[model samples]
Target: MNMSTTSTFPQTDGVMTPRRVAGAYLAEIRSECLRYLRNPGFMLPLMLFPAVFYLMFGVLMNHGHADAARYLLASYGVFGVMGPGLFGFGASLALERDGGLLTLKRALPMPPGAYLLGKMAMAMVVSGLVMVLMLLLGVFAAHVPLSGAQILGLLALGVFGVLPFCALGMFVGTLIKGQGAPGLLNLVYLPMAFLSGLWFPLSAMPSWLAAIAPVWPSYHLNIIAQRVVGLSDAPVLAHVWILLGVAVGLLWLASRRLRRHG
Candidate 1:
């Protein structure tokens, strides 16, 4: 009877193996990537806005100033990353939540982290494409000279820097309705860009206003990008820690809100 039962049931654990879990996670990431790529409204703005701005300000109106071109290259790179991180997490998640998508996803047998991580992976992919396009424009059109190391460093920072913005977006998504997310994101995105000096130098602003530069994550990110391009000498580790702290805190808040609502 025991042998017959074993033969019928099979001698195996019910839990998924690590490889199976990883496959599922990767599948989720692929789905997220495809979803974002298929949406022209999302993809177009994300790809074009930064490129066009770089062309107009960094290349065309750069006024024979090589330094200006290089500086804008770094600054616009920061600007490039912000769009994917903010809108990807904020607007997308809010829409999903309001449309009952998240509820449906939750009912699936997949791991919860898969969903969040998939979204993050998608953002990273989009952010990476933006970085590549910006760098290409900087090299070919703007003629901004950068060392191989500097280019690599800027790319790395651009990818990693999406975290704090994702956290901020998640927090915003959890708090607002889907319909309001795009408007709210624009309100946050543009002000933060202008205030953080992504469009211009903070030093050009009033001293009091410049003092608030450190208050924005984008400012810190720009500082790091500048350091990569020999534009700033600020302490790098301090900026890294500040971003880490902000990401952690915002993620905590977002998780709490999700729990309450879920």
Candidate 2:
């Protein structure tokens, strides 16, 4: 029996090598990317909605206006990054939990964190793609002038800036059933975007609305993006701290809920 088992299991001791652990993570990430890419209902809206909106408002409407193009580019980039983090985690996770996939994965022998990390990796990738699409429209279509560093900075921001929203989405996923997640997230998503001034400058909003804009993560993200693109001189350290805090706090809450509920 020992000889037969040793022949079947190469490791012999039943210990997972480091390579095996890494492969598990890579496999999970690959599966996540494939799953989302294959779902047109999910992928199309996440990828195109912001790009279309940017083309209409940032490119066509703001044609030949460099300042408008720059501002909208920064704002819309934040808007674009929000979708993947929110829907990808919030809606899909709820649906997966309903389908019993989360439980199945928990019963698997893989690392516990791999599941969430896989979703996060996919979100970051989608966020990066969305930023690329927006930057292309801003540069070629709108004729916005941005240096290489600025362009790279904005791209990096979109890729990493998605974490707080991901945490928020995770928390939301733990709160409701699958069918309700999308609608509830939309309620949070659209209003937050508008309130954060992603659609337009807060200067145009009422004084009270403008005063409270800083409460939104998107607002702080927009400030950092604006600073990166040279549209604003706002100090970035405070905004960075705020976003970090939001991400950490929401993630802690979500993990607790997932443990208790899932």
Candidate 3:
């Protein structure tokens, strides 16, 4: 006598209900947040460095100069937010890919975007914390005069302003090895901050340097930030458009690379 057996598998599309999709994203975000929270080495520096800079430059060095404190607050806030976007997305993604975690995530029963979204949420959380610290130092410690609306505006900017850097970092992550990601990102980060006039007003830089400052995304962000703080009357629309274009372009390129390489 002979026996025959047959097996049937569930269709992949049938498993992805809206409720499950939402849960997957939430779970991923929670895990990502918890993982970073547990890593004090990473979180401490990411959160503290900007506050330290703000305290040193905006408060102590300024010696109660209202205008200088206000200016540095805007500049350092942009500088602060850039770190998480670049390091959180760029370094983490590259390291996970190298460690085989990214592949395992792809093989798991979760949304394709859950991983990236989780990291993005974590970065925003860090960015918000850093921004809040900067604001507190600016308001109470440094005595920079910021109205309620201005404080809220800068907070909102700090939260969402990380996206452009996230896209750029994502692209860079896809292009480099895990070990090289941090170094390469720092190369991009610090120099971009300086060249974008995040440390000093463009007017204070060389004529050629000031002329090229507009080429950096941070310059536009700083412009908008200064406007938020009532320090600059520069038009905001052009900067917004430029940033939006840069983010979309980098995200497009990053997605293509991830699909091909991963």
Question: What lDDT does each candidate get?
Answer: 0.90, 0.90, 0.89
- Taking all chains together, each candidate's TM-score versus the true structure is 0.94, 0.95, 0.93
lDDT of 3 by residue, 30-105 (tens): 9998898788877887778778888887787776578988999999999999988999899898888888999998
Evaluation by TM-score, superior candidate among 1 and 3: 1
lDDT of 2 by residue, 97-185 (tens): 99999999988887869999999999999899899988998888888889999999989998999999999999899999779999999
Relative to the unseen true structure, what is the C-alpha lDDT of residue 10 in candidate 3, on a scale of 0 to 100? 52
lDDT score for candidate 1 against the true structure: 0.90
The Cα error of candidate 3 at residue 219, in Å, is 0.5
Q: Which stretches of candidate 3 lie over 4 Å from their true place?
A: 1-14
Clash pairs of candidate 2?
none
Tens digit of per-residue lDDT, candidate 1, span 43-92: 99988988999999998887899988988999989999999989999998
TM-score rank order: 2, 1, 3
Task: Sort the candidates on lDDT, descending order.
Answer: 2, 1, 3
